[model samples]
Target: MTTTTSQATGSSAASDGRGARPDRRRRGKEGPAVAAVPVVPAPKLRRRPVLVAASVAAVCLGALLGVWTWSSTSNTHEVVALRQDVTRGETITQGDLVTVQVGLDPALKTIPGDRLSSLVGQRAAMDMAAGSLVTAAGVTKAVLPSEGMSVVGVALPPSLMPGERLLAGDLVRIVATPGQQGDLGQEPPATVAATVVGIYPNGENGETVVSLEVPEGQAAELAARAATGKVALVLDSRER
Candidate 1:
């Protein structure tokens, strides 16, 4: 029994020694290692470059806006030459620029160059076609003489179209003579002189009426001539 006990005690001591050796070796090899913890992510190196670019762009934009504001505030421009139609027909008023048939000198019937400045605001003599003449009568002024003259509606031949050539004031002779005589076949021609006040053309009825202003006493004879004999228009010479 003693021998078995001694062998058993010796085996246990050997086992304990072996275990202690292994534990000491393990502790020495490890050398007090610390527990592993979660590592923080490194910051992106590209973020610095992106932030600097954004700052520069913002500064540039601010500078550009400042420059634009300064230029607009101090800018000065001339009031370029502005030509507008001062006169127009009854349908037109001031501050209106309508494409009208302006008059050109009759001598310039055919233009050598393509530019035709004079034919801008002239109204048509008749219902104008493309190649028609744009005379002074074509376009009408938006205004008229309020106090100096007036218009009268008279029944006259259409062939006697005035083309609206009568101006503000004009004078001529008015005649009213008996066409046939009672004694024989001859009668003395009678005539008188009056002033042209206005011009009225009847497009619908194909009639041309001349508004005239003359002595009040001659209104009777003038009306009589206008009613009986054919009314004739004679333009006064510039000399008179």
Candidate 2:
């Protein structure tokens, strides 16, 4: 009975040793067990149609504005302008005008630069300052000394007239002054309404020769008073 027990123990020990060797050999060949790493997909890019469209529209509008600005600045017109000051009824001349380039509205009445010849002999209808644009209604062909009007030349000393410079279209009154002998009459001073036509220097004397346009009926009387150097000029309201 003891010999049978020993043979059974030896057989069980050999079977256990064989199972342990196979597991050790498998572990050595396979190396250490590693945990798997999870793969993450790349994040998808979201497309915003509104943002893209706005960018495109902005670029187009910028280009359009640039083009419009360039076109507006390039567009210009040649027109007539005054090179010097011209008084009312003064004849327009070539030397009095200049050709200028401007971007003007169509509603503005400006004379064309090419029509300078047509305006040379015409008269100014109103007072025009230097560098002013010439207009159609600013010139005329009417005679200067109109019907029923007479122009009288009056030479006045500085004391007889205002110190202010007088223009051609200025309204004035020629008032008769008392002579050195003095007036014996008690009547009010005789005053004649007149318009200044032109002004000229009276040689070396400190006197101004003013051409006065008055009614034909008053011309002779005004001339007699002016010749005596006993008249004073009073400026009237210049407003039209």
Candidate 3:
């Protein structure tokens, strides 16, 4: 009975020792338990190239605005401008002139404001409208009927004149046709070159009275020819 009891006790001790060895081996093989950590994704990379492009565009626009503002405010001058419409050969009076401040372009020639006084009494070389800048090519002292010239009025029907409308400063010639006295026939009918100085409607005959500026030597002859109602006005291609 004692030996049987001792063998049972030894068997129980061997079973306990085997269980303790397996537990110690498992503990050594596994690492210590650690608390679970929450995972966070990294922030997406910033769009650096897009940001740089926007900044450059803003800077360029600012620079352009600054340049335009500077140009508009810089380098201006005072010059002469016409205050009224002056027809060719019409005299310029004080009421016809005005001064304006403008930025002068190197390619455009302009008359100075100080010359406004000198422009008075001079005739316009061509038709100039209001708000036009007065230049050296605008006015001249050469009158339409200058020095030794005389103006003669001729009554002419529209059909006997050129098709184009005639104004002052037009170059024209009077061609004599069959007069009331007799036939001018051939002989190329005497031609006299003249410049138009004035024009007006004559009565209600649909005829126009044109004032021709001709030399004093030929004024009487042309007037006599026009009185016959056989004179025609020829417009020359010369422009003012």
Give the per-residue lDDT of model 1 (tens digit) for 126-213: 2333333333454443333235433333456644434446543455665443345533235544655665544577798766677666
Model 2: per-residue lDDT, tens digit, 1-240? 899988888888988999999999999999999999999999999999999999999999999999998888788888999999999867688899999999889889999889888899888889999999999889988765689999999999899999888888889999988878887478889999998978897879989999998989999999999988889999999878
Q: What TM-score would each prediction reach against the true structure?
A: 0.34, 0.68, 0.59
Model 2 clash pairs are: none
RMSD of 2: 8.7
- When 2 and 3 are scored with TM-score, the better candidate is 2
What is the Å distance of residue 238 in model 3 from its true position? 3.3
Clashes of 3: 0
Model 1 TM-score on a 0 to 1 scale: 0.34
Compared with the true structure, what per-residue lDDT tens digits does model 3 show for residues 196-233?
Answer: 88779778899999999999999999999898888899
User: lDDT value for candidate 2?
Assistant: 0.90
Say which candidate scores most in TM-score. Answer: 2
Error of 3 at 234 (Å): 1.8
- lDDT of residue 16 for candidate 1: 90
Looking at model 1, residue 104 earns an lDDT score of 38
Best first by TM-score, ranked: 2, 3, 1
C-alpha RMSD values across all candidates: 15.3, 8.7, 9.5
Task: Give residue 143's error in model 3 in angstroms.
Answer: 2.9
